[model samples]
Target: MQLRLQQRLQERRQQSLYRQRLTLSSPQGAEVQIGTERLLCFCSNDYLGLANHPQVITSLQENAARYGVGSGASHLVVGHSGPHQELEEALAEFTGRPRALLFSSGYMANIGIMAALLKRGDAVFEDRLNHASLLDGGLLSGARLQRFRHNDTDHLKQLLQQRADVEGKLVATDGVFSMDGDSAPLGELATVCAEQGALLVVDDAHGFGVLGANGAGSLEQAGLSAREVPVLMGTLGKALGTGGAFVAGDEDLIEGLIQFARSYIYTTAIPPALVAATLVSLELLTTEAWRRPHLQQLIARFRAGAEQLGLPLMDSQSPIQPLLVGDADAALRLSEKLRSDGVLVSAIRPPTVHAGTARLRITLSAAHNEDQVDRLLDALQRHA
Candidate 1:
């Protein structure tokens, strides 16, 4: 077994697909400390930049003193506290849903939702570019999983037509493709689901707390209601700059998951103090209106500058920007060069993206100023 594992590891390294982690010695922000180097960061998912907000930190500290550190038990056990219930209510109200049920993380939320709702004979349809968690959820649900071409509504329509005899049909998609940074055509997918008598589930981990007028996510931005998109899964760790995730829908859906979702039933709840911090972060998410527009402006500025530099840019209106580089080694080289220039961007290689579509997954945060964006562009111009 050791020999086999070593061979597989060697293969990954030879292909330039080995994964590594960066050690951050400072809090999350536009700039972060690694070792003795201070890097202008562009790979964090803290889009609204509330992760290190003073109010958020104070709320966490206060709540930690009040509730202590750990949840101690699962939500179905004695662990669900005042903050948990309050945050659920606030999230439901924010998403305009009948109820919201929290999960320990976005991956668990997606997995539990699929397992609770699907069984044998049910058919699950997913976009080819949906997040790995969503795809894994469908695969693990004991249902027939079908992946349609990425964002191709026509292909999805045909797949649904072919599987018309299946009574329980589910369509899952990422509200925002994580690697490519392109948004799912939510409006189109919702319409397709309605026509095909299938349920639509959106994992809006990247879109929530960043898009929309009230930061209610891609659904609100697309003018979609809870009825149109039945299952909405979002993460607090991203734009909300907290932790955990939730599924917002009608009361029946939340109740069903509570009763049947094993992941939710068995796993310990997130810390009540963290939830308290999240509540404060959620308020700041909607109230601090400047964050969203400032983030959008940064995205626009980066894209325009990249275009002028003849960079290989993808069509993404969100904060995630990908500069496509065909070879994995080339992508890594570009990332290393940017790091040497005092900027931090992640090289997204195969498995995260396609074989020939390796890219630098550059993310923008509202905490960043115009100068920081220019600094990133300057580094890219020198290295990319």
Candidate 2:
């Protein structure tokens, strides 16, 4: 067994598919430190740059003094702290939902939502390019899972029509695709789901705290109400620069998740300090509206620069920009070149994406200034 495992690991390395982690000694920001080297970081999900904000850090510190570092138990037990409730309420109001429930992570929230809502005879239609968590949730639901082409509502509609015999139908998609950085055809998908009487689930982990005028996320951007999209999931660790995740919906859905979602029922609640820090970050997400526009500008600058340089850029309007390198080894080489140039961009390889579609996943953050973007462009030009 050990020999087989070793062979499989070696195969991954030979295919350039082995993954590694970097130890960050500094807080998450546009510039991060690894040991003594400060690299221009363009691979973080901190779109709005609230992760290292002074106010967010202060809130965490103060709340830790008040509530301690760990949540003592699960939310159903006694771990549902004041800050947890407060953050839930804030998120509900922000998303214009009747209620919201928190989870330890986006994966748990996605899994819990599917498990709570789906049954053995039900059907789940998902986008082919949906996040791994959403895909896993569909599989775990004991439902007949059908995957449609990326952002193709017609394909989803056809799948829904074919699955008409199922007891229940749920359609799930990522509001903003993480790797591709393109948005789902949310309005069209909602229309199809409505026509088919299928409940729509949207994971806006990459969109929340970044899109919309009020930073309410992709639903707001698409003019979708709670009625249009039933289950809305968002993570606090991305643009909010905090930790944990939440699902917002009408009262009944929240109540059902509370009752039937085993992932939520069995897991320890997220820390009060983290939740408190998220509250601060949430506040900043809404009130400080300039962050979104600044981020858009940065994305535009990067895209335009990449275009001029004739980089193999994907069609993405969001902060995530992929430079398609096709081969895993080539993508790794490009990433290493940028790293050697004091820039941090990760190479995303299969099976995170399809084979032969390996690319450099360069992410932008509002914490980054125009000059930093220029520096990234310069490095890409030199290395790519």
Best by lDDT: 1
Local accuracy of candidate 1 as per-residue lDDT tens digits, 231-344 = 999999999898999999998999999999998999999999999999999999767889999999999999999999999899999999998999999999899999999999
For candidate 2, the lDDT comes to 0.94
TM-score on alpha carbons, each prediction:
0.99, 0.99
TM-score of 2: 0.99
Task: Look at candidate 1 and give me any clashing residue pairs.
Answer: none
Runs in model 1 deviating more than 4 A are: none
